[model samples]
Target chain A: MHSFFGKQLPVAVAFFSGVLMIITFFSGDQTVADFSQEQLVWVTIVGGFSLLLGVASITRVSLSDVRKRRKGWPYKAVLLIFLVASSLGAIIEGTERGTLYDWLFQNMNAPMMSTMFSLLAFYIASAAYRAFRARTVEATILLITATIVMLGRVPLGELIYGKLPEITDWIMNYPNLSVQRGIIIGAALGAASMSLRIILGIERTYLGRQ
Target chain B: MNHDIVLFLEMTLAGFLTLCIFSFLYKDNPFYRLAEHIFAGLSAGYYVGLIWHSVIMQQLWVPITQNGQYSLILPGLLGVLMFTRLVDRLSFLSRVSIAFVVGNTAGISIIQQLHGFVLPQLGDTMSRFGQEFWGPLIILIGVVSTLIYFYFSKEHKGALGITAKVGTVFIMVSFGAHFGYTVMGRVSLLIGRVQFLFVDWVHSFNKIIN
Candidate 1:
């Protein structure tokens, strides 16, 4: 009974849902299309509920830490307080655009996210300096290409060389585009095969087992 | 009470949070940790609110109640079933919900990947061949050679080895170009932060002083 409900039922459900979606894409019938679209909406709603699982997990972890008086438990407490306060504020306000929710997002969340991302610039610069050594032919080509693209992308390149932008454009349009296209095709094919595997029930990894 | 005063306060708070996040570059400290925790909690709360309002209320609840689409109740039930994973005996029930998501995504992606990515990219690559001489030839060589490099079924030797080597060069150049572009993007983000600090915050301060 466990295997019947756990393994077989789930696989059947997945196969049915997947086939319906594919049918929706190909079928010209408005009724079928609408039904499929509605089903997709249900999938999205189900996906959204998964977020609650995450929140629950976090809450459980934080509460356990607080109870244990763990190191950095104070920070965990602060996190939980903010989490509860912000959620309550949003729920009470009934809209994210409401005063407290909007303010917290704009003042706290946005700035931190932007600043954290911006810090990557410094890290990338340091990494490039360390990693982009001209050791071999391949490395030298990479270094040269990186230098050209970097210089051509900014005003400094034009200040040094008049034709840098033109060369950069040529490289981007031809060789870069070709390689990008190759990669796209390869990745698309790979993804399609994986999707097929899932649909055919050959891939049961999603069921939490090999 | 004034709008300008409100704006100034918001900008000041944002700038302070931004600086706190940036302080991580010096070393991990109390200020950075506070900002990080606040950001995480607030963002998670915001997402929860958003999912409830936008997805659940708009898509599921409204359709079921207002439109009398009672069929949606099934998927909603499936979504609720996802929580059964917390229970030892009923944990298998969660597989049904996951199956729906996996199947739906796979079905949708298969056709979209083929139509949107694979075919168009191949067509574009082939179409470019007759348009120009050297440019197209170079692109063709790059694409073919790069594809060969990615083909791991046959071991590289003799002619295949040289082709794979050429493919490696193209791949390296492509990677370098991508890295350079990413650096430029990150630098631009950093520039935006600097501008916000120096221009917007400073100007606001001057306005208050005046």
Candidate 2:
């Protein structure tokens, strides 16, 4: 029963959906397309529920910590309070504009997230300084190209050299496009093959072992 | 006066959160951790709000009640089933929902990756051949060489080794450009936060005094 539910059942479902998608894609039948479209929407709806699992887990962990009076328990308490506040606020008031949820998001979540991300600006430049030492030919090329691209992006590069922007554009259009395309093709092929494996029930990793 | 006070309070909270995050630059402290916890909890809560409004209400509830789209109920049931993972005996049933999502995603992505991405990119690369000779030539070399570098079936020796070397140079340049762009993005976000602090937050003080 365990094996069936855990592995065989999941794989069988994967196979069915995978085959259905492939058929719908190539069939050129309107009915098939409509059916797949419905299936896709259903999948997205299911995707939404996946986040609830995270909520349950975070709540469980934080509750346990608070119960235990762990170190930094005050922070966990704050987190729980805010979590309940935002989720309940949204549930009661709805998520439309001018709601408490929106206000919380606009004031608290947005600025905090942006500031956290912006901190990486300080760290990444410092990191590049420490890491990009031009130790070899590849390193040297990377350093020079990075410097040129960075400079070209800012107003200072154009002020320093009139042609810097053009050189940056040329590099981006040619070399960057080529390498990115190569990477994309390679990744696409990999993903396709992986999808095939999953559809065939050859890839069982998604089903956690009992 | 009340509305102005509310606005002022909001501005002050946002600025405080912004400063809390930036305090990480000096070192991790109580304020940073408080902001970090708020970020985690608020993001999760925001997602809950979004899913409730966007997915449950819009996708399922309205569609069923208003449009008589009874088909949506199946996905709603499947989504609800995801909560059963909390109970050990019924936990296995959650895999059924997971299977549906995973299968559908894998099935769709195969074609999306191949037809949507690979075919278009390959066509674009080939189509560029009729343009100015050197630019296209350089791109072609970069693509082919980069692909060869990724290929690991055969040992890199002699001619293959040399080609792979050229591939590395292109890859490095592309990587550098990517790095430069990422830094620029982070810096721009940092500038926005700084602008908010100076132009918005500090300006509010003047309003209060006036």
Candidate 3:
């Protein structure tokens, strides 16, 4: 009974919902389209609650660490405290305009994310220096192309050479565009095939063990 | 209680956090760790509140309470079932929720992948042939050869080997261009932070001083 509901039922549900969505896309029926749209909303609602799973997992781990007095228990405690505080603030104040939630997000969250992401700049430069060595024919081409593109993208490139931008544009438009299109076509085909497989129940990986 | 004072405080806090995060470039330290953890916790909490307010309150709560739509309870139940994964015996119940997501995404993606990606790319590639003489010709060749290179069933030998080599060159050039573009993006982000520090914050402080 457990297996029937847990495993088989879900598979059936997926097949039906997926087929319905496909029908909604291709069929001209207004009622079907409306129902499918409603189903999409349901999916979003389910996905929204799914976010709590992550919070629950993180909270559990943090609590366990605090209880065991792990190496970074203090940090874990800080994380839990902030998590609780921020969640409470947002929930209590409401996430509407001119709220504490918005203020925290704008001031703290956005800056931290952008700063963390920006740190990749230093790392990427270091990586390029190490990896873009002109050791072979291919490596040499890659190194030159990368240098040209990087230079063209920045204001410093124009200062160094006026034609650098034009050359960069040509490379990006012709060769880069061609290769990208090819990659995109191939990926789309692959994705379509994979989607088909999943819909048809050929892909059972999502079900996880039986 | 001047608005400028609050704005200044917010800017200063953001700058401080940004600098703390950037300190990771030197070495791992308590300040960096604290900032990183706080960012993680706060973002997680923010997402929780955002999703609740946006998806649950709007889609589930509002409709059920205000509009009196009871059908939403089905998806709501399924969403609740996902939490059962935390339990040892009841974990299988989560599969139902996963199936719904997987199926719906797979179904919708079929038409979307075809319309959004595959068809447009195919049309674009084909249309390029009519636009210019050599440029489109070269693109068509690159696209075909690249696809052939990825076709692993047949062993690359003779003409296929040469074509595959050309395909490899295109792939390498594409990768190099992508890496350069990514580096540029990251660098721009870094530049934004620098600009904020040197320009915006400095001007604000200057105004306060005056």
Please state the Cα-based DockQ of model 1 relative to the true two-chain complex.
0.74
Instruction: List residue ranges in candidate 3 displaced over 4 A.
Output: none
Q: For each candidate in the order shown, give its overall lDDT on alpha carbons.
A: 0.85, 0.89, 0.86
What is the C-alpha lDDT profile of model 2 across A1-210, one tens digit per residue?
Answer: 877877778889889988899999889999989988888999999999998889888888998999999999888988888888889999899987899899999999999999989999899989987887989999888889988999998899999998889889987999998999899999999999999998898886775555
Best by lDDT: 2
Clashing pairs in 3: none
Worst 10 residues of 2 chain B by lDDT: B1-10
Off by over 4 Å in 2: none
User: Worst 10-residue stretch by lDDT in candidate 2 chain A?
Assistant: A201-210
What order do you get sorting by lDDT, best first? 2, 3, 1
Flag regions of model 1 displaced more than 4 Å: A96-98, B86-89
Scored against the native two-chain complex, candidate 3 gets a DockQ of 0.78
Which candidate number maximizes DockQ?
A: 2
* Clash count per candidate: 0, 0, 0
